[model samples]
Target: MGEVLYRQYRPQTFSEVINQDPIKRTLKNAVEAGNIAHAYLFTGPRGVGKTSLARILAKAANCLKLKGGEPCDACDNCVAIREGRFLDLIEIDAASNTGVDNIREIIEHVKFSPSSGKKKIIVIDEVHMLSKGAFNALLKTLEEPPAHAVFILATTELQKVPATIVSRTQRFDFRRLASSDIVPHLTAIAKKLKYRIADEALILVARASEGSLRDALSLLDQLASFTDGRATLEDAEDILGLPPFGMTQDFFDALITGGEAKSFAHVDSLIDRGFDMAQVISSLLQYLQMVASCKIQGAGQMESGLTPEDASRLREHASSATHEQLRRLLGRFIEAAEQMRYSKIPELPMQLAVMDFFAELQPQPSSTPSRAIPKADTRNIATTQNKRGRPAPQGALLDMREEIVGKWNELLEKMREYNHSLISSLRLASVIACDGETVTISFPYKFHKEAVEQRKNKLVVEAVMEEVYGRAFRLLCLVSAGGLDQKREATAEPRVVEVASSLGRADSLLDEAMKVFGKAEKPT
Candidate 1:
């Protein structure tokens, strides 16, 4: 097989490392000022040029007559180091030889001066992997090395490196290359290699690489082989196993508006295609997050790796769901993803999650909107359901010919606990006429007459009557002396009464007194 693209074209000079201009500038100035440290630590994520830059820095330090703070790439020292044949320069992979014995060898070599170059250089990659004993063995040399030796250590994890070693060296942090930076670099490399690749294909590779230039170039190399030197979007997708962007969006829309059955269908199809449940959920979460981003910052500014058409589809789906609804859905998917690990049937939980999401959403009413009750009208106006099953017309008067005395003495007893005065008047009155909506009561005295005329009292009595009979009725307080006299003569013999109870009297009071006094004289 041919040499891989990442290794075949690795950066050879300080200017070639991408997305780390700050670290390069500082190192170059240090070199120009002749202030290079005896030991240096280069730390960052993978494929960010930690080891490669260490080699370059080593060549620059040992280069004869360095200029412009950069190595003279044409010189014997630079070319020998680049070809990995420099006698005095040593590169160790600490991952495989992390024991103290490997470190002891280096410590012993530090006693000798440079044989061919200006300084003997040691580059230990993944230095964090060294055992505690090995680190201890290297500590003395690291603190006080030979004047002709330089140490350059590189690691991806900075936290694992001991503070003692870190405190004794100069540290440089290399940043990951950004997508915008990685894309152009990959595009250029693709063209130089005579491979046909589009900008979108390059972008996909850049995003998948996730800020590592070497990973991007590696992916490009893989794609070139898979596509027979013509890398296209389909080739990238096939190699990476990424689902089409449109399918994920349609899955979301079908879940939201297409009902439970359609959503189940979509999930079945996804399963049939052998898509991993974990990958499906992860992609769904990312897609929902993209929708949420568009909701917050307009759709014109989504940063997802999706194309314009996919972004448009996302915005359209988002329009159907409110922010709260989407938030709830996201939460459900997260919970499902968590439980998916322990689930016997992963699709079962995911399917129920979708069903539950739809089931929880309430459909709006079609016709009447709920409203508060309006204030009631105030009138002495009484309404009744006549024999014809309709409201009686206005100004309907009560007929008084039928005499039906109300049997309410027990009711009167109950009312006395609430108000003794209302029950006292009720004791002296009788219902002489009754309509379904109105009742006429004849009061024996003016006090009773005045008490019943109070609207609050009348309303309370009317409400009680409605509760008792299931009908609304009104009360008429009438004072009558002749009517009481006529009833006394017909029912029983009249009797004389003494005038001992009279204290104060109005004309209505006198009329009310005679009516009740006359009724009391009747023989039962």
Candidate 2:
């Protein structure tokens, strides 16, 4: 029954257009100098005033009383163009009629003078949608249009348009409106409509619009109607399907401060409120990024568009954590975002991410002192596990695991000389236990396990071990359940004396080690 907000307030002059200063200036200069090109191309993101500017260009060039290369709103040419009743100003939806025949219709009329206005303006919106043949048909018309005819083309996707067409036309890129620009515009519209909408509501709408002023107005209009002109931030957020800011803050505090219960509680609230898990994770990532930026660049940046007090609260919350911690938390949140895409219960990914962050924060034991093995001897560290291989005592296996852990990297490198893919498979596998002539290693992924246990790969692994030990050892590969996180821990480090007593050849290894370390192996 009424005009939409975006259409109701479309800009009628170059000066009135929002946030496209360079484009406006260029077009205005051309008009003022009577240097208008036969064809003009406008390229930019959607909802950034491409189509609107094309219409304004038409009105400006054809206006009876053009001022400084801009159309006067009072002029007959400008008013009719604004009201969409100007006969000489033709707007074609190239998206619907994208064939050669459709383009020929325009070419057939090119020679005719303006029906009423000074210029015959043809505005082709989404010109990139025109068929290849249609573009070919239109190219000639654009290249050599009648003196009184002007062609204006607009496209959201600049690359799809043929370069030949682009080169012939004068080009202008429309820039997106910033939130700082969007917010005030919405506020002014709300005031004009006599809506009691809060500034918070306007900011939410502006952010949700993401630089699209048309979408921003549409959202504000929705909020105003839903609230009967008493719109609040909560109403705006609910209508826009945004996650609650308070919950995001709570979740951030819980995750960074080792409050696992509070973290899950916040997740529960978000799930109960029907907010998407992806949105929650996304908001958390943004929150951490802002806090990290504040820590590095000071609170002056306020990149998240939060209120000053909220920013201060964020800075205080982030003060307890180091930049390294914030970065790690951000990483976990990002990982959870990807996982959410494949997860059936989307909240499960976020929950798992929360658990992992807390687990990383858990205190770790001190590093156990290790004996330096000879570089040549380091390759003896057995690679991985297969349950079908030789078995041994728990004590013996634990002792061998200590040896394996000490030189795991060396073992992997030596195996790499035989088969790099074998070594790559082993990267996902870790020595968990051992036997007299066999070692047990667990692989996190089935593909790695399957790849390593392939008959040929298994032989290479065994050969590399034999080369290292001067004796044969069976290669065993086991698929570890639950992936890398579920891989078993290495055995506890035994005392040096105990290690020597158990290995027996630890005495020989120690003798070889003495030359390397240039020191005697102490009893401790």
Candidate 3:
């Protein structure tokens, strides 16, 4: 049997590395110019061919018959290096042996000239994993090495590599392969292997690989072996273990369309299939982002990363969801995902979180029916007064309170848009005192008061006040000094009445009956 696909398929020459034309061209030119740096730094994400390119550089630098800055693969030095049998070429896994001693050994080895090859080369993979001490030891060799010595350091994480080391080395950044690049590569490989893989199936693998050539190839190999000679879309998905990717967007749509029955069932199906709830939430966030992007820049100009199917679905979902609604749902999914990490009853928290949207879908209560009343029979308005039996001062403060009362419904609407639970709590707050410029409102209990006093809640109150008053109004939440304690305050209060009024005969009879009944109430 041939060697494993990833290894046997590894690029031997610079031209064979995928998605790295610029780096290959520059390195080939440098080799032809005979201006190779003593130390080279290769930085990029995984599977973009950083280390592979480093190996190719090692072979190219050591090849006896190097021409046009490219390795003569038929030469003894190039063949030996390719086979990992060259005495002059050393490949070190810095992640495994990241110590000063490992670096010291390399520095010591730099003194000797090549035994057979034109130059002795060292390739260190994951150089960011090297210990601080090792990095310091390696710096001297990087600063100046023998004319016949070359060093290639590769790292996925560029930030972790020491600045001193980085500054001394010639750097080449490897970019992620575009899907355009990835598709052709996967197709060619599939064809060469005699595997019957569809273009769409290859595209799926490429999309799932996320710009990693090795990952794409490995996934391809896995799918190939799993399906024998043929790789189907279903086989690709089954092996890769990702959701349809459309399911998240579908669930988002179902929730928005008030498809209550479908929403819960969708979650159940996802959970039953062993999809991690956290990952599901993450996918939902990603889906929301795509929808938002599509909304911002219409379907014709989506970001390059999105597939055509993803772009179409995003446009459809974007049409159904308003920006405000999308913002709210995104907030909710984020909250759920955060809570899922610490929740004791995992499903309950998420379920309650989602149920919030369901409640929005419930039919609103109808307005109460009313009968007309005579002018004399209608309730009279009470005069607001101070403790001195004098009318309270009125001006801006009075106008503010009146503004809040008149626009109370609008305020509550805004609160609901921000967060439903906030509006639910705010419903219990009562206007305890108002002098016009500064109005005091109080919640019936401390819990409700604290909830209202939160920074976000305060901001919401400010926004509503500004909307109604056409100016800012400061709201003071207070417990009246003599009227009510912070707790045990009634949300509703009856107006005080003077002693001049008298009850009718029917009311008197009802009072007498209530007195008699109050005395003998312990029948149980």
Candidate 4:
């Protein structure tokens, strides 16, 4: 079988490593100055060339054809290392050799001088896999290794490596390659392999790899046998489990504008079609990134995967939402994608993300609503207030409260656009009075009062009132102290008593006092 593309094209020199210039420069300078550390640590995500570079570094230190700390692939040492036949270069898979005994063997080996190469280079892959005892066992030798020994450790999880192990070594962190960097490299390999795949297919492979070039090429290698090597973008998507480009836009459109039902329906459709939920969410995130970029930088500046029409539609959606809102959405999409990695039902994370976004976009009441008012006649409200001797409200305050009440139904309808639960609580209550900047709502029960008075629910209520009143107003929530001095509450009091009683009832009573302003009880 032919060599794998990644192995075939692995960097033999630091200059050949892609998108890790800082690491390359630092390592090359160290070698050139003969300032190489006793132990070196390489940390990064999988398949970004940490292991490949470790091998290169080993060859560079030992290669007789080294120029300015870079290895010449023509040299015997480089060739032997490239062909995996170098005697002095030792490779250990820590994952397989995780015991203290395995580490003790390394300690014993480091005590010897190089047999063939200039340095006895020890390369430990997935070093973080070493047991605590193993790490502890090597700490002394790693800190003070023989002059002829060079220990190089590589790990995907930097945090797992002991600090003592890490502190004793010079560390280089590898980065995940971007699509732009991976695509060209994959294209060159395809040409060498006689594969007739298009750039679009190559791009699909790159995106599918998610920054791992080895994974991308493996897919390309698989594609070589999966089809006739004349793979199209659709073929790549099928192999990669990505839905068509526009499907992501459709998902977002329904997700952002439509409520929970529409969003879930889209999720269900994707599931029915056998699309991977992780890939779907990832594609959605990519689409949103384009939208956000298009909003920040003009559409002309964006290279979206979406077609022109779809891109234009995205632009419209972008223009409609605040950039911060788009940012928040992107953050949620990323978080959901990460959470799905460890989930039992991966679809659940995406579902939770959808529900969260739905809640964020609008008002939805709590399932458990609080009681606000008793189901009874609202008729006695006004009459009972007059008998309580409450004075008639005058001028603008009365006008404002009355206007709020008159449009209460319309406002509640509008409230549905934000949170349905808001309307539910408001339905059980009414605006009894307003003192200019503060409008007090009287609920029939405490549960209804407490439910609506909740900070979030209260904000919705105030926002709705502001939309109706054309200004801001503080919300004051209360449960109606409906019953009054029974006989006195049924009879109109004298004007003198009205003045005194209005003062007392203003703070305590709801409808019975509100009726003193002669605002007849309307519908609840």
Candidate 5:
């Protein structure tokens, strides 16, 4: 049987390792100077070369013939270590053996000297899997081990490892390999294996790997076998289950062009093709991110893997969008991606996200004037309401309350266009009273009241109020256990009161006219 590509192409020396240049240089200099740390910790995401570097370090420490801090792979010691036959080099899978007893056995072995090499090397992969007692057992040995013993610990999650263990070791963090690095590496390997793979195919593999070199190689290995040592872009897409680049681009264009039907058509087409909804959202997000990057930093700053044509297309898309629009769309798709995980219907989240974004772009009614109240003023009104008492309604104020109560349903209907969730919370609330500046709403449920009282929700409610009533009014939410009727009766027909200075602001003549005659009709 053929050896797997990842195993066959593992880096045998520091120079061969991809990326993490700083860590490689430091470790190599230390090895050459014969100043190796007794305990070394390598932390990073999986498949990025943490274990490969650990093995190389072990071989370098005990290599009979070393050259420029790199182990001479031809030497017997290096060969034995590479072939997994070295007696002094020990590898422990901490995941499976995480008990104190398992750790005790390693401690027992540390007392002895190397059987074959100059230094005894212990490599514990996934070291964070060790239990508390196991870590405690290993802590002392890591802090002060035998002069001839060297401990190498590697973990993907550094937070799981105790601080005591981390402090005792020399920590080197590895980074995920970049697509630029992974591409050439894959190309080189493909050439060595005499495989015919397209450049686009390699790029797709590199991107799909998400910075894991081992994963990229494994994907290449799968592609080679599936396509009989020849792979193309379509093959990679099929194997990786990624949407076609053009389809992703079109979908994003639909979103940017505000073509709700076109966007939904793209999603439906993807669903019809049996594509994973999460992957579809992810691909859109990646394309959106690329467009955003191009918009902000130019196409030259885009990550590697784009064809010249792709880069040109991205630049064109970037021209059609503002940075803020791209940011908001990216946020919406990200939310869709997260919701897809829990959704029973896979495509629903993506569809909803699309609908929501387009809805935001929809033009408001002509009767509703542009927002005159600044966001800061709204925030101030909300703050003042929370810190002070609600003043009783006067004669005109009572008439205004009646008008608002009559149009309350109309307000909810307008609010539905902005936020359906806010409408849900607002439906539970009763308009108990309305002064000229503020509308007091009472909710039977505390949670419902709190939901409407949130800054964003309150803004939507107040904006909808302005749309329905032809004037701006702050919303004051209160939880009333005795219901709206009792709360209204308790304060009914109270004496006229002056508006608080903080809550009252002078209204423009136009606003006053609109409040009295409603918005004026445009001339025919």
Candidate 6:
């Protein structure tokens, strides 16, 4: 069997490693100066060279003919470590051996001298997987190890490792490799193997890897095998299950310029073609992000890894859309991507996201002018009759209604302090009318209306209204099928019974009796 690409091309020396210049420089300097610490911790994302760097450090520390802190691969010590046969260089998978006994075994061996080199290097991968007792067993040794012993730990999760263990070591954090770094590296390897791979295909591989060089190389290996050494852009798109860049661009253009109908039509076409909705959304998000960058930083200034024609198209799209619109679309689609994970119907979340973005762009109705309410008697002004025989809110009453609507957001903020769930229901409601005696709120959803009509919730709203408007007012919640624009019918009244204020007042006694025994006629 042929050797895998990742293992075949694993970095064996400090100079061969990709990215991580600071970590490389510091480790090289330490090895050269003979200033190696008793313990070292390497933490980073997977496939980003944590384990490879640990191996390189092991070889460098034990190299028989070391120069400039880099191991001479020709030396006997370096060759054995590279071949995984060095007696002094021990690599432990802490994930498999996680008990106290495993750590005790290491402590037993730590007292012994190096079998073949100057330093006995112990490399523990995924050290965070160790049990609590195992960590405790290892802590004492990490705090005070022998002169010849050296421990190197690597983990993807730094939080799981105890602080005591962390404090006892010199920590080096490895960063994810950039596309710019991975692309040329992959290109060099392809040239070495004499594989004919397209530049666009290489870029796709780099992007799909998402800053993991090992993953990128493994993907390239698969492409090389699949295409028999000649890989094209189409081959990559098929193997990686990514949509074509052109299709993503066209969909984005339809969404921005062709309106909701055209955008949704594009989505339907994609679905018919057997494309995954989540993958399609991901592709759209990547293209949208490129457009956003071009808009902010100009096409000429971007290193977007796209052909000139593609860059120009992105620039044109950027020019056509506003910054705010781009931001809103990005946010909505990101939410759609998250929602797609748990959704039974995969396309539903994306459809909803599209609808919501367009809905937000629709123009809202203009509100009435804000006029100050007069402090004097509003009874006379409220007595004027409208066409429906209801008292018309003329001067002060109309002003008061407009003022309350304007300050609706402030009332919600105050309500949050009392009941957070009520605030959510209230947000879906609109204040249609606010008279001196009653404030009528219309909700499109029946459940939202029911939530606000509960006696406890009603009293809370009325209390906040009194605090904000300087007087108590009854709440009248109506479930309107046609939203806030629908007028209430006298024949079909709301089902919620009216609630009175609990604040100290003479009428409180009568209101309490009405709740238990129903209303009674007053003695004349």
- What is residue 213's positional error in candidate 2, in angstroms? 0.6
Best by lDDT: 6
Residues 388-500, candidate 3, lDDT per residue (tens digit)?
64644445334435555566667777665556556544544554334434444644334555767788878788777677667675666532222244253333121011110
The TM-scores, one per candidate, come to: 0.62, 0.69, 0.65, 0.68, 0.73, 0.74
Candidate 2 lDDT, 353-450, residue by residue in tens: 77656644544211111322323443333222235543234455556656655566676779746664354456445554345566656554455668
Q: Write down the lDDT of every candidate, Cα atoms only.
A: 0.70, 0.72, 0.68, 0.73, 0.76, 0.77
**For residue 127, what is the lDDT in candidate 3?**
97
lDDT of 5 by residue, 1-524 (tens): 98999999999999999989999999889999999999999999989999999999988999888989999998999999999999898899999999999989988997899998989999999999999999999988987799999999999999999999999999998888888889999999999989999988998899889999989999999999899988889899999899999889888888888488988888888999999988888888878878887888777748466678877788899998987678768866776776676678888878867765664454422111122122223222222222256433244554666677678778877875787555544644555445567786655445566768889888888888888899988787654433224444334212101122224423432232223223332211
Candidate 4 overall lDDT versus native: 0.73
For each predicted model, how many residue pairs clash, with residues at least 3 apart or on different chains? Answer: 0, 5, 4, 14, 0, 0
The digit string of per-residue lDDT tens for model 1 on 25-84 reads 888888888778889999999998998888888878878768888998889988988888
Regions of candidate 4 where Cα sits further than 4 Å from its true position: 258-260, 304-310, 324-328, 331-335, 338-346, 363-524
For model 6, give the 10-residue run with minimal summed lDDT: 365-374
- How close to the true structure is residue 208 of candidate 2, measured as C-alpha lDDT? 73
Task: Provide C-alpha RMSD values for all models, in order.
Answer: 26.9, 10.5, 11.9, 12.4, 10.6, 9.4
- lDDT by residue (tens digit), candidate 4, 387-492: 2455334444456566667777788778867775445456556565555566666654455578688899889878887897788888876544341233543342
Ranking by TM-score: 6, 5, 2, 4, 3, 1
The total of clashing pairs for model 3 equals: 4
After superposition, the stretches of candidate 2 with alpha carbons farther than 4 Å from their true spots are 259-265, 301-309, 325-524
> What is the TM-score of candidate 1?
0.62
Q: What TM-score does candidate 3 reach?
A: 0.65
